[model samples]
Target: MDVLITGANRGIGAGLVAGYRARGAAVIAAARSGGDVALDVTDAACVAAMARALAGRAIGLLVCNAGVYVDKGERLEDGFAPALWAETFAVNVTGVFLTVQALLPNLSLAEAPKIAIVSSQMGSNMRANGGSYAYRASKAAATNLGRNLAKDLAPRGIAVGIYHPGWVRTDMGGAGADIALEESVAGLMARFDALDMARTGEFLAWDGREFPF
Candidate 1:
């Protein structure tokens, strides 16, 4: 199996790459700044270039793991700037769409393809907390995007699933978060492994429970 993971330089993304490789899958690790493949998902030209480079390769899995949480510590009164919202959405929401759009051809080449979107529980309407508005909104959008893509891609033999990787201890998740990187990655790979057309469009957690939309 061939897997392509974005933002694979560190954190959950990096762990996914390592775990997949250990299982004997050909892993293509992509990152915005640096990795096996240089891909800035926010940049359409960069994503297009990446697609061109991997034109003939079949990607069994595409993990849209690249995202941003710029509103982590921002105050509601003074910290949520307009530019910050734009910046966050560009990478967190728009980036996911662009990556999927560009890689559709590669996915189609495979007999069965799956797209794993690294969304968050923050996106869940039922689990809405007060802080990190921009992050939450972008994640919600990403989740919705995955749901819609699932509807559109299933007929083409591509399954799309949105997942929350738990409150992991990464640069984005913080040290005080609920789980370790290893735990989150292990759960996520299992979730990815279980994804199929029958379960497409489902919002699920890394631990296999269905997440509330």
Candidate 2:
């Protein structure tokens, strides 16, 4: 299988690249810098070029993992700057849409292509605990994008699933987070394997539990 993962320079994205390759899949690790494929998901021209580069190859899986969390400690009164919101949404929301849009043709060539969007439980309205407004809103948008894409792509034999990879010990998740990077990667791989048309558009956690929208 040909699997492409974005934001693969570090953290869960990097672990996923290693895990998928160990399973013998041809993995394309794409990052803003220092990856098998040089890609800045926020750049439309870069995304288009990537699509052209992989012109005829079939992509069995497309992992929209690129994201940002700039509002980590921003207070509601004066924290979430306008630029921060724009930057976060550009990468976390718009980037996912552009990548999927550019790669639709490649996904269509596969027998059963799947799209795995690495959203967060923090995005869930039911789980909202306040703070990180920009990150939360962007993730919610990402999940929504994945859900809609699942509907539009189902007829093309593509399955789209939004996932919360758990509170993993990564740069974004922090060292005090709940799980290790390997654990998150393992569970997420299983989730990806189980994805099909019947389960498309579902928001799930790394452990296979349903995530409330």
Candidate 3:
């Protein structure tokens, strides 16, 4: 299996890339910082060019994991960096849209393609709260985008799935999260192995349980 992970230079995205690579799966790691496919998820033209650059290659998995936070869980207009909110969504939501649009053609060449939009429970409309307003809103949009994509791509045999990585201990998730990075990612990959059209379009937790939208 050949896998592609956006934001592969750090955090869960990095772990996913490493996890797949360790399994001997051919991995195409994409990141704004460092990866085999260097890309800024927000740039449509760059995304398209990257996809074309990978043309004719097998891409069995696409981990749409690139995202951003509004620095300190703060929202613009009420915060110092007024532009932070838009920048957050640009990378977190719109970026996912353009990246996938760019990669779909390349992905169609795969035999059993899967697209996992690594999401979060902060996106849960049923559980919405006050903190991290910009981050929460963008992820919620990304999750919905994944749901719609599942429907649109079903005809092409591409399964689109969403996930909540939980309050992971990462640069963005702060230092107090409960689960270890390895544990969360391991559980999610196990779920990935069992997925098909039957279970696509669902929001899943890193532990493989379904999250209520």
The candidate that wins on TM-score is 2
Order of candidate numbers by lDDT, starting with the best: 2, 1, 3
lDDT of 3 at 146: 94
Which of 1 and 2 is ahead in TM-score? Answer: 2
Pairs clashing in candidate 1?
Answer: none
TM-score of model number 1: 0.98
lDDT of 1 by residue, 1-213 (tens): 899999999999999999999999999999976688899998999999999999999999999999888888899888999999999999999999999999999999997899999999999999897899999999999999999999989789899999999999988889899999999999999999899999999899999998889
lDDT of 2 by residue, 158-199 (tens): 999999999999999998999999999999999999999999
Worst 10 residues of 3 by lDDT: 73-82
In model 1, the Cα lDDT at residue 46 comes to: 98
Report how far off residue 104 is in candidate 3 (Å): 0.9
What ranking of all candidate models by TM-score puts the best one first?
2, 1, 3
Lowest-scoring 10 consecutive residues by lDDT in candidate 1? 32-41
Q: Which runs of model 1 end up more than 4 angstroms from their true locations? A: none
RMSD of each: 0.8, 0.6, 1.5
Q: What is the C-alpha lDDT of each candidate?
A: 0.93, 0.94, 0.86
Please write out the lDDT profile of model 3 over residues 44-142, one tens digit for every residue: 888888988998987888888888876664545566364877798899889988988888887899897999998889889988977778778888999
Per-candidate TM equals 0.98, 0.99, 0.95
Ranked by TM-score, the better of candidates 1 and 3 is 1
